[model samples]
Target: HVHGHFFALLSGYIDKFQLSEEWHRFTGDSSITDVRKCYGEPRAALHEVCKYACKFSDLDDPKLWEFHQGVNGGRMFDPAGNLRGVLTGELDQDSLEGLSGPYRDWVATWLWLEKKYHLQAGPPPTMLPYV
Candidate 1:
């Protein structure tokens, strides 16, 4: 699922703008409950994606922190995509561990690009990637 989502984002078949729109259309607000209401119960991995989106949107609020804490600190995601253990992939790992690994690194890289390009990967619509 993570592979498919990553490739969907990477291949230009579905851009962040489209995702942002879909997020807005589904969520109707920034609340995860709303996300659940519209998209059903999202996995822990999906929550990380939302956190990244919130960061991109400059959503420096307590709810975001709470959400982070709630979803992280568990090995739900697969760290190596190996099938040996529970392979939840990039979406289910704890926050600190993930920060030390590839997901957070990728987020940092995207943050750099966003800063350089003055773009955002989340809500408010206008700041999202155009292409």
Candidate 2:
């Protein structure tokens, strides 16, 4: 019974376990050589994955914003305090219930397609201060 709360919690795990610098310790590789290597394919870097995911605007709805907020909070914004992505919003408890399943499924589908097609580089989207 995955819900918005669960998805929010899972995002933290994804960032900490898959996207952090300590990922090398888990993968036993200093540099990520393969996108398939990490759990949820998160080793590719958030900006890269964000660009890849942004192609499908349908996936960028409020659920995505909530998920990122749960994981990284305001850290996604630029130093100038500009929020990333044109579509941004706050998620409420009511909306979370409806979006939970669809959000998870969409992410899974995106990762599978990304692996199958080997999507390449593009101009980084305007998200996160570091990006």
All models: lDDT? 0.38, 0.36
- The sequence of per-residue lDDT tens digits that candidate 1 reaches over residues 32-130 is 222212244433344445445345345355665676688788665553333446534575454432112111122322353243222233322222343
Model 2 clash pairs are 76-128
Give the top-scoring candidate (lDDT): 1
Model 2, runs deviating above 4 Å: 1-22, 31-48, 53-103, 107-131
Best by TM-score: 1
TM-score of each: 0.24, 0.16
Model 2: C-alpha RMSD to truth? 17.9
TM-score of 2: 0.16
On residues 1-131, what C-alpha lDDT tens digit does candidate 2 reach at each position? 11111112132223343433444543344533222223454434433444543443344547666765676744533422232354546542233211221122113234533433243434433232221
The Cα error of candidate 1 at residue 46, in Å, is 18
